[model samples]
Target: MAPTNLELVTLGHRIRHERVARGWTLDELGAQVGVAGSQLSLIENGKREPKLSLVQAIAHATGLEVTDLLAAEPPNRRAALEIELERAQASPVFRSLGIPPVKVTKGMPDETIESILGLHRELDRREREAIATPEEARRANTELRLRMRERDNYLPEIEKLAEKQLAAAGHVSGALTHRTVSIMAERLGFELLYVNDLPRSARSVTDLENGRIYLPPASIPGGHGLRSMALQAMAHRLLGHQRPTSYADFLQQRLEINYFAACCLIPETNGVAFLQQAKKDRNLAVEDFRDAFGVTHEAAAMRMTNLMTQHLGIRLHFLRVDGSGAISRVYENDDLPLPMDVTGAVDGQIACRKWSARAAFSEQNRTTEHYQYTDTPAGTFWCATQTGTTADGEFSISVGVPFDDARWFRGRETTKRAVSSCPDEACCRRAPSELTSRWEGKAWPSARVHMQMFTPLPRGNFPGVDDSEVYAFLERHA
Candidate 1:
């Protein structure tokens, strides 16, 4: 006789089947359900019984009703076949062909069917490795680049058409979000795929297969903008020329557009206004900027850095310091005379000394520490520090402003304390032979650079900081 818990095993198998039908592997299913794949395997293989909660979790992850999952037996042969057919129809072959298999069956020759089957087998063999290896995907991205280039030549015509249509409609006042752009694309009989929050500067790409457009958000100014523009150019190619038959075919059209829309809508010149507002507000940090402008932290930082460098003529250096006093510096500033080269600096030697003095003074006087430290020649300096932890270990981010004494402000410090000893002591002292002679100068061109310091804080919580406050502060100061 079968085990008494045969029903449970059957249910687990059914759940697994449904997940696989959706093109999800067991590990992916387990992750969605907050369980280990090994545990899920045990449950499916009848070695262990899943809890009630696990059953619900599986159902949720698979998008199946609990009742459907707990049914007495596997789906009927017809139902099973239907599921397989759906999966096959959703395959890349069908997508590239720009038609449904049922439709393809009516017109396709036997040779086409065989070729498609061969392609499917090849894709299956490559699927796991393709996903695992970014280098492979990047190499494959060459095709996308070629496709994007082809589309770019025809962008002006597409943009003209879109602009004309929008102008004729006389509707351009409301904010342009991803949903709005998608609706517009749809009105033009184009499908839409949004990537990375659909930044305002996102450019549209045309899908020749489904006659749709894709829009991905632009996060930075220069390279990001160009990429978005390329995407828009690609969209133009799709809308203006190519035709797509199926949804997957549409996705296959490799159009590249970066942040062209953002540049058009939010010009870099406006950055000064944003920065001025941020400076006054004291509350305007990365997250608030992200939410308000719908951008990422890295993007916002780059934008702010650009504005500071370009308009204000301020030099900004970003430093990553490990607990063991290893420092990596990235400098950005067009106007400043400081070398923008990225190099390792002695961690805790300069910045930490300033911090130690500030911390000691703060503790002794029972007063918050805020002062200027101008020892180097590039100019007076302003600095702020924040502590963060990544998979590698704890780090301190020190952002310095060149030639500005008042740039540093006292914010809430981080709760996590740094380790007592520096981790990179040997390397820190191991000055390169080339630099040994140069290091002797009291105020060499490079040594004259000044940097301010801000104490480290937790990653997300930058103590007593808020977006509104930052905006207000910048506005008041401006």
Candidate 2:
């Protein structure tokens, strides 16, 4: 495709910067380029695309070759512009404009492409002004989940890399311990130090120059927390993850690193063997596996999801929620229909109160895990959830499988079950007719029950983190 309007804007900005650095006014540059001052101003502001002759003239005036002036765009910037261009082309309004959709390639005139992009900007502005409701959010989530489903939520490339790393480490079937992690760090010429005063925001920092890794007290647990953090740092070192220039690259890297970390704690082959045995015994329990592997429940649950879907040949799903019933994380490789927003299975949307992930918050005994059978439009699912207190807040993690796969879990016999047709107004959001009749206008002053839903912070790679600070830290160490 031809250079996008964004690329033109970038070129214009560079030209303006060069002119300003030379202390030349628009009229001065216009005289040098034999162009009108007003037109030159527009060209420098990207309001107009200069002709090739003008570009050549400007390049000569600036004592640079035209090729240098129009150097290839940075990869990340080009990708971003291409994404914007694609979105614009796909926009209904753009199609309605009756301008034949054309690729922004060398064949297309830059002026024509810029004109279309200008209209796209107008439509984007209108969209930004429109207030989005909860339903729209749900639709977005649905689309995102659909994409995940397309891939079956499996990363063979990551799995292969993990296996290779595991083999290279001479890792065997055993519980990952603190001493083991420390030894791993030592072998890499890093000294692992635990400090009580490490800031909460800094989980762990590797001082590359000093060959030392600093961890907070809470993360020193000889188990999951420490191991996960250490392994993540090791990934940064071993996998050669450079600072990502785009958000997409950053997210992909984070996923790969986390997957590698999980693999380090639970080697793929060993994890698969244990899960197979658990399936045969019909006694699969996340907590048991967690304790056995010396990993956190969340980690074990993630590993299990991978095992069931990617290796064990059983479809599975996982959900995590905070105390307020806000979804913190969710994923499914099964056909179970999950409530979604425009962005896909979102992180902070309030889950159906009847769902096990939400219901687990009300359990009187938070010490043990909770299980439930839920009937949704998709199918009946059996889920096990555990609520735990973390430094930030109380959270719960739940793993689920379709009814047919329930026989593989120990808590399959629980009588706790509920019907959910969520994202539907007639579902659990409304009280049953029988209950409404009994309580309607009798006991309460207002007679209306309002469920307050709060939008939590967006979750992904470092949901509430200062990413710039992270990059800065990494760069400093490097």
Candidate 3:
């Protein structure tokens, strides 16, 4: 095994050849694979060896088996940097980043982790530099923190929006029905090839000559939408030319498509109907809405949020908290002037205390636990328990709405209770055994809090919609 110089040289040549075939430039390849262009060049020329991980990356990127790469026929040796550049070009990272392909030799160091950290830091620094004022910087920091905290839930919406856009552009079809697109592709005699998730770089590519389509894998459990998207790429290949000039353009086109699709699927009037049902039926939970509308819980919540704001004129603040006391996502109607930095823990605390005090006071006063409090910045408020699902698990949503002096309650104290105390601490305040422990002591027990107000609109606002029509729609749909 130690006597094979030819095997090593052959590997380098194979790597270089694959890189060139992929249409990548050496520098671009180097950046993608976390190596200097010069370093990749050296590897390609057989002057230096790349690490095993790099070889694996090259194999994956070039669609070559690892054993085959290590066993290719040796070619005449080139300059070291040239070989390295060639090797780097044939890597998944390079392909994802749109870098040129490069050939790499065995034994190079793995720099991907360092490179990722460096990139993240650079982005953070750039964001900081873009700020014009301390207040702006603080606000950005708070938003960033909130995003990080709510990433699991918030990011899914981003993905959904992206999918919607792709579908709208005819770049994807049958997103609403997963298997429909795939069956169509099979009928067209196209083989489905899956690539890694590329974030903003996620793309679908078609080879004009060979009719090969490459597409990013679905980020969620369902593959139907992704399959449809892949079939669309195949259609593009068959149609020929008119390639998108830039990734941004592609994304924009897709987003527009999705917006139109959403409008079509969930019309403004339909949204109004959902809101009317919520208004009339006190027993209507998030699940009931999902069942009624044939949508996911998040979708239902988002729809309700939008309708309550845009149509019914409701200013609503909504948040989701899991049983573990972690706040998930928050959506507020524009009219509700809540502070942007409100933490999930704080909202959870408000919810738990309110519920606990209500139960306790109900027993003492010999009355129902439901009551209104007027101490907070939001003024007189009605509180209720709503339920929803989270990435981690199920959750109870505690909703609070201000009824009077909304301006005073906008940023002032809401009630006499502290936002962090556990009402049952003596008996039940142990560390949560789940993943929400990090957010446990913050302020709220729930994962999220969304609060908003509902506004009554004129009869003609939703042209064909009246209160009875809205109720009838819900009855049929729900």
- Candidate 1 lDDT, 162-189, residue by residue in tens: 4444444343532234444445456666
Best by lDDT: 2
Query: Stretches of candidate 1 above 4 Å error?
Result: 1-176, 181-190, 194-209, 213-270, 278-291, 318-331, 334-380, 385-399, 405-478
Tell me, what's the RMSD of every candidate? Answer: 22.9, 10.1, 19.6
Q: Candidate 3's C-alpha lDDT? A: 0.45
For every model shown, the clashing-pair count is 47, 19, 80
Least lDDT summed over 10 consecutive residues: which range in candidate 3?
455-464
Model 3 over residues 328-419: C-alpha lDDT tens digits? 54554332223233332233232333332223333334222223342333334434334434485556443344453222222223343323
- Candidate with the larger TM-score of 1 and 3: 3
TM-scores vs. true structure, each candidate: 0.31, 0.63, 0.33
What TM-score does model 3 achieve against the real structure? 0.33
Candidate order (TM-score): 2, 3, 1
Clash count, candidate 1:
47
Predictions in order: lDDT: 0.45, 0.74, 0.45
lDDT of 2 by residue, 52-75 (tens): 898899999999888876764522
